[model samples]
Target: ARVMVAMEAELQQHPAQGVLVVGDVNSTLAAAVSAKKLHLPLIHVEAGLRSGDRNMPEEINRLATDAITDLFFVTEPSGQEALLREGHPASRIHFVGNVMIDNLFHQIGRLRADPAAGGRGAALRAGLGDRPYGVVTLHRPSNVDHPEQLAGLVGTLRTLASDLPLVFPVHPRTRSNLSRFGIDLGPNIHTTTPLSYMEFLCLWKDAEIILTDSGGLQEESSAVGVRCVTLRDSTERPVTITDGTNILAGTNPARILDVARTALAQPASGKRPLLWDGRAAERILDVIVDSPLFQPV
Candidate 1:
């Protein structure tokens, strides 16, 4: 609501410029409505991705935002197909590839140069100290809101605790849910606050495996050649599964345990590069500049 009001104010103040809205669904929708009202072109990044579950607010956001966007910058060909299925004009959709790929490439050189990156990897190994460990991150409301779901995930983690350390960077919302439900963190499960992007990337790089409910992390884990077990039933990015880098475990304890065990049993192998060549932003800019419809504000 606050975002809507702010966008309305911006539209009222200056209504002639093109506006691009980035981020989650709510912000995208708010920007779209404002852009339409102001007769401005609206661009949506990370467009046309869906988890196929109406229970998730993000699904609604993706659909609603795409409805009003003038330019849809998608990460994958699948996203373009999804937009076409929804009746989005073919000319409006552009597969600019994943911006996160651009981000990762931009940072790789720096990460390699930084002593902290190596030190952090060493520190993670020292902390685990010869014990196998898997990184876990949970933030979805579906899992955290329901006691049964939360308990199921925790139970799976507990079972694996003897063989592997589960490093969980608990989202504050999930933490609150944990307290509300009285879900106890087992001794082998190390819970901590969210890490910075660099810190988290380093951890992901070093982990034997990753179990997550985050779409971005799922992609990142695959990009770094780590095996990922997604806690969600479905994913917007299905390429990870096709590439054999990730498996959807849902919230089923048995499924989660089985998948995690399988992932641990296998030798670590890098996944095929599925994102982009790290020039997505440049490509997007080139396309925009070349397009006849493009007019810089």
Candidate 2:
């Protein structure tokens, strides 16, 4: 593959004892394959995750990475069980919490320290003016791939927006989907380009409710005590749904609307899950230091 060749050349010049790949994307799979071919230790972060749906590219990426990685850094206990069930050696698995949450803590501080830099959040406030509002973010193709689905989903959100101002910070793919599907964001729905992380967190934290198809947002919402309605039927991050404040509504427009309504009526009474205390990066470093692969040549 093109990626493997590129990685091989890079490694040849600057040899590494180990290579670590984060998140389940094409790059992670490519790095894991290259590391295995080179006989170098591979560390996989946010590993041992599955949605039980092999049809999803991410599910396949996670499976392949776990199959070959020398060690795994996981976010939750379910990851442990998933790896164990797949016959992975228990000793190689390490639960170091959600590293993403560490970034969340850092960005929250940055947003608080400099409210002027609240990029998208500041602009949102200028127009919406702190009134009770909701947030909607959609990107996954399962929810918006087809014209019918995209139209239905947007129509539902438009209906919800009539009651409360809904800010949709659109992803590039979803923006294309809107045009391809010939759908319009109605008067009540406000759409903007993608927001910076700090701006997004600012918008999300104070939201009355959030309707999204994002796995990370589920965790982020739970950490900030925000109610979330996941537009997906299932999520790899089940901890957010079990201990945190996430509810899966599938892709059905009616069901999504219903879930959003329920979320708005209820309080964000979700508690932060275990090990989401903003020390994940520290724990990750400690694990890396202890690994024999990290020993000096």
Error of 1 at 220 (Å): 1.1
- Clashing residue pairs in candidate 2 (N, C-alpha, C atoms within 3 angstroms): none
CA lDDT for candidate 1: 0.80
Cα lDDT tens digits for candidate 2, 1-297: 788889988988899988989999888899889888989999998998888888888989999999998888999999999999989888889998998998898888988899877887777966888598989999998877888988999989999999999999999999988888789999988888999887888787888888998878998998888889998878899999889998988989998888888778867777899999999989989988888778887
CA lDDT of each candidate?
0.80, 0.88
* Residue 26 in model 2: lDDT: 88
- Candidate 2 lDDT: 0.88
Clash count of each predicted structure = 0, 0
